[model samples]
Target: MVAGDGQGKNIDDLPDEIILNVFSFFSFNELIDTAQNVCVRWKRLAHDPVLWRDKEYIIRGRAQNGRSCCGVTCSECAHCRCEKTDREVLRTAGSMPQLRTLTMMRGTRARILRKICRNCPNLTTLQLHGCQKMNYSLLKYIFEKCPKIEKLIIANNLLADRRYAELVSRLEHLQSLEVFENRRGAGPVLLRFLADACPKLREINLSWDYHPLEDVEYFVKAKRDTLTSATVRWTMAGKRCVVTVLKEAASSLEKLQLHLFDVAPEEEAATFADLGELHNLRELHCNQLCPHRPRLISLAFQPGRLPLLQRLHLPHATGLPDDAVATICRGCPALRELRLIFATSLTDGALAEIHRLKHLQILDLSGCSGLGGCAMAHVAQLPALRTLLLQYIDDLTELQPSLRHVLDLEQLRCLNILNSGHIRAVPFEEFAVRLVNLRELHVTYEEEDEVFYKNVFAEMQSQMPRLRIINTFRWTEDDFLTDYETDDDGDDGDDDIGY
Candidate 1:
């Protein structure tokens, strides 16, 4: 039943299913701290096991005595906060018998962790972040307690022992694993152990300071048939291994990330060619290798090569050619999100082809200085366009026409024009009034004076009170002095701009 029906009923009159559905949106802390005290009905529903199952309980922040904060904001209390937190976790874990995912961040105490894991018998996914105290014994204890764990994300921990590999290999049910900054001397041994032991492993993300070519290739080749997603980072010395990973995982790979830096010229040219053959690839992300290189993207991005490609991110892609962008736009018609930040070589011709992506929703062309007003005008024509980030484009000086075209997109919710200093305040304010559906506006000017922008901003606030306007422009002390020195009677051209 509707809460505000003509019978004069309230939310308490609603069915348990509807109330539980609303309660599902509340965080674990909110449910325990606030919802449980609301009413007798809500108190019972708050303790329901379904509410806690499969939820990601993130334990972060500083606690007294260097223990995990457990979402509490107490520094000094009569009772020991650490023991209180441990009791709370143990009690919460009893309510979450079906809990599947548990995430623990920095400052988590050993006893508290053991208490939660021992109670959460069905826990399958464990993510440990910045837990410096997580040694080999603590991890092994966790593995033993939570034997059903299938996915593990251990980041920025202190597990530098090769003996940790022996414990990891014992998890026969493990399917996905992500290790970052913990595999210093044990990376090679861990990969070798995982290849032979972890039969169900389908996705793996390994990131550290350095990657040995021999170890990476052997692991990739061995698990190529089962692995569907891989995130591998390497330097100039491991170029051949990068190619081997792509070549081996081409058939089954659906998601791939290559964080290649300090790459040799010849190896860089040969490595990118293998990417075009991955027909099953749905998402591809590559980091910048060299800014001075003539072309970072390969010419192999032709039609029908990557037909299933949906998302492509090439951040800091310096010297990226316009034809490559054109080819990606034409070939990857199923593309939904595209981010080519700092790709300076792109022009209007490349952006013109981008409108062909009928399903495109998010487009971030930040720092592409080569694009001008015409390129932006074409980008605003995408029907499904919701987020448009055109930051750091100095050549987009003609704001009035571009803003007029942009305001026509009824679905456009976010527009980012940060660091584009040439935009006039009056025209921007005028066009912003028409973009009624716009939820976010990110704009900044490099001009010294702030008087003109201040007036425009005030007017915008009065006109579009619901719109979120983020301005990164900073005014200097000289601009304030200049404003005070100038006569109020003097013509500042505000009249000519029709403001």
Candidate 2:
């Protein structure tokens, strides 16, 4: 007869559907803790698998620091790198048995991951990227446990594990595969097996892989009519292998990234010809060669080429000393979006050139060095530049001076100055307050770089209050390599800041 007794009013009060509905609203962790409570009715409601079926998992990107100042929101934050917090949430989210989608990236720990993969039997999609700890056995376990996996994404690691063979073998049920630099040479004949076994596979991504010539040839041999999209990543040094790619797979290829960095061309004419011949290709990303190879750049910009090119990516990774960008921007007039990474070869002159193209909708100046107030002071005058990306450029140390210049971009809708650490803190916070016209803004830093995000965002909330959406991320070498917990202070303070 006691309130805590078996015959208490708890069970008699609510119907099955209502209790399950209530449980469904809570996240995986909240539901778990509540299920373990002494209340019998609450515990009974937790057993319904239907309660967890709606749970979706997504990688949390960097978000705007939420700090308001006297009815105005500030733009800067001290804790932009939300790595530790996001990882903890991901770990807890794995408790849900009926999880349909799972996105675990940026060096996720493998500690409780086996439990995560094993419990989520009904999982339909999995996105694994920058997860340096991902091992062969763990991946095999994941594939076997999640039999219904229709989409699989494993990307961005230099060290290749034997798991590729295991994963490729099990992907017989998989419809799409996204891979980045996976090393699978001696891991059985999995490629051969995948070519035959996975008949339904329509898309395969090999772009960004630092693969060898022989391994590339192996990929080309995998002929399947179901293959509609194939992405390849090769430096000019391995240019000879482009023939294998074109002869074997170009007929059905839709996307390709022929990036040239710290390397030179081994095969010139055939590679360029193959690139031009992919008649069905809709997207092509060709970078200006890094070495003293002006001819390679000549090859990419030959006459009237790449007609179907919808999206183009150019490498402007950091430091626009005297404004090298002004020269680089002349090559691509058809580009709708541009990413000028911290290549240190650009300046106000580069931003000036982008202004000439009427087509640029999106622009990422994340790490282009020397690109502070002086350059943007010029770009603010442009009419077409809508989106701007500025993450992890250490040279932006003089931001206050640039702050007055940057705010001039009133027409800009999305301004992403996410982890421009070198930018002075004073004007950085000031811009977040004044940029009210800014619909979207990002001041990002990842896990260890969580120094000034909160402070900047706090100041920002008080200045700008109309922001509808903000996303953030940690995209440096340290996030994926060098254990976050093992060496919190290891970066000597500069990394994937990888210019």
Candidate 3:
């Protein structure tokens, strides 16, 4: 008997399960409202637990936020125009009792999550991306509440507490955790707790933040066995440095990053004995080391070591001789993705040995100050090259000088050279014209005139019409003028040098 909502019969007059089957005709949003209007039996069937299955959790909460996924359940309220629904979604989800997966967006409620955790003990997968207001008290409550959580992802929260490690240690069944770096000094204990409790841990990303150069070795020596895929990022002298520590503990470790460290001291080369132990070492990244005296190249590439190593980043490198680059090219024939950033002393002659990489694609020469036109021209010769970053090569002071040299960037898809201020010499119109196939551009120059910018916009709109994202550029102090005139200019004809 279908009732008079238009179907023209009495559906409330049907059996409980049949009425639920009828209510299921409406969408989840509609079900929330229709559930309230029907008779007690129809309402109970519409409010059945199975109807509230896997509510898409848009939250950045802990995997175990222990919160019930709910909105204010307001019916006919201004916030949600419905016909008087329960003021809490917890009542609906609580009735279900078997809620497993939860993804959340924002949380302005109390331990509503804790109530959900206490009710649904079988919860597994959880992803929280934007719950900025949700405090750690809720997170701490979830950890204590939800003990069986498996996959947990938390991003962008500053919830620092004393017992973060203790709580994580208690989650004996935890696997796959990607935590943001801790703002305080609590992470070390967190690492220790993870190591002690989560014995089967395979993937770990810990922030080796600001460990003085002296302590890096100490920490490495201590945790060499446990860190599988670890990146230690820090700042030294105001430059970005990302140091990756990986080895035995993370036996399945794959990627590693060690950015800008002044490691090239003139001594008996340092030992990467722990790195050699990994046997699965694939990618290694190291940024700007000090100088040639304690050569980093000599330390690692002695004859035929780091054999499993393939991808390398010696960005902004100094003191490394052309012969070392040549040796590595010759030794690591499988090498690819060589990044020579800010290579102040590297010359085009050094790159003559690039024939070594059997499968090279990405060559990042960003900030390579002394690498002028000829060197760039040589780089253009790589047959398999795909992505090239040539930002800030002040040596290419002339525009077309290096622009024409990059003609072979045909295989290129991504190009980043922002603030490469020397673009004034290059005809920006011509580049906007030729590189139509280019996808990503981050080129910038210096100028004080607003008209130059207007031209740039008009040119970009016409030139690279296919561009996805144009990294904005600016000309800082270059927008100013310098005048050089004297009050006694009339005496210039025959005056002494000083006069």
Candidate 4:
């Protein structure tokens, strides 16, 4: 068979299915603003049902620099407020018939929500965050219109008293609910209603500034048998209530996060005792109002307690002793992710103990001042270790040994070495050739060393074709020192250096 000339084929010549698949990679705003205006075929593919199955609308106030201002009111700043009306935004969503997941962030109103409910009937997940003016009637309208909603997240909203409970009760099929920092409190009636009406509910996350402890206890007790994951934070007055709730749910709960404020030594000890009962728990995260206590860490790793635990996060655990770290490695052999960020007391001995956790894949020891190059030798022994983050660990000067070890682990993909001031360009270049599977690498450098690092990165890119290197240059040390000195009371200043 003789072949015809096939030299110059354009993108427009592609099939509709292929074109639609290409359009699927574009963001909702990109499709609407840019893709649709290209041509007739692109416009048709951009509006296809496949592209709109899962849509998100982020309504942010306009900042002065032509970016979206986050979590702040428009009136308080010099930035021009977002002029796009709620109706205008909803109009785009209303056109989509196959929308299943919808997320609205900041400044969403009831009318806009009503429009979504009226339009997108297939919505199974709805998340609303930092909304200013939400009321009971609007929620009732949402529940009535969208009956299939299974997952709902309402955070940092100004909801009225009893309204949250009423709205939640209306969704009989709701399987997961996350309420964070809701201004008004829910009464016993709401708790009872959730227990009785929502038999399928399996996950509940209630945080900051919630209702009374008694009401929360009642809710947990009502749904204890079916609930699998629960995160609760309460004041010191509600300590006993939390303990009671945890004890009741211990049998079925698989994931738990407890944040207690103003707790005394006795109360903390009492709460740790209840954790032993949660034999089925697989993940645990603890944040205390006071300084990290060694006793609490010891209690958490007691033999045979939380045997199935796989992930443990103790972000605020400052001064965590070496013995506690050793105990954790021994007790939780199955642990895959261990995060002890800001645990200042951890030393090379603790890192040595970490080698026992053979199954650990992710290890974060950011801000652990005592760690040095010796610890990296232990990290190299883990067979499954992949993601490693060691930010702000000031003493990590040597990486040639660690890099040589890291190169052997085929699964090691993401490595972050941000703010480790002593790391130089020579050691990284030696092992950069061996990281064939590395997808992301975050490194820190001084402002003057930008050109040098960029050239190094360009050289590494030639060797590892798939590598994505992120360079974070340091701000002046004086900036940090000034902020640190001005606080006097040891408060974290407004200046954020992560960027």
Global lDDT of each candidate: 0.67, 0.54, 0.53, 0.66
Q: In candidate 4, what are the lDDT values of residues 223-303, reduced to their tens digit?
A: 888889887763423444475566788888989877754555556666666666688888988774243356575676777
Off by over 4 Å in 4: 1-54, 64-90, 108-110, 155-160, 182-189, 234-238, 288-293, 398-410, 473-499
Better of 2 and 3 by lDDT: 2
TM-score: which is higher, 3 or 4? Answer: 4
Worst 10 residues of 4 by lDDT: 481-490
lDDT of 4 at 19: 73
Per-residue alpha-carbon lDDT of candidate 3 for residues 43-116, written as tens digits (9 for 90 to 100): 56755656545433322222222223343322222222111111344554454343445554334244455666
By lDDT, the best candidate is 1
lDDT of 1 by residue, 1-499 (tens): 3455577788877799987898888765667668878888888887676776635554444232322224222223211122224345666655555567775544345566767787777788887754334555566778998998899876523323356676788898999988777433433334677777878888888645455676667777888888898887744134444654557878889998777555567665555566677888999887773433545454446788788988899888776788878888888989999999998777777777888899999999888877755765788779899898878766466433454577767688888888866766225665455677777888885567578777877788777877888887454442221110112222333221100
Q: Give the poorly placed runs of model 1, Cα more than 4 Å off.
A: 1-16, 36-44, 47-49, 53-55, 63-101, 122-124, 155-160, 183-189, 212-214, 234-238, 291-293, 393-404, 419-426, 430-434, 444-466, 470-499
> What lDDT score is found at residue 381 in candidate 3?
67
Q: If scored against the real structure, what TM-score would every candidate get?
A: 0.76, 0.58, 0.57, 0.78
Give the local distance difference test score of model 2.
0.54
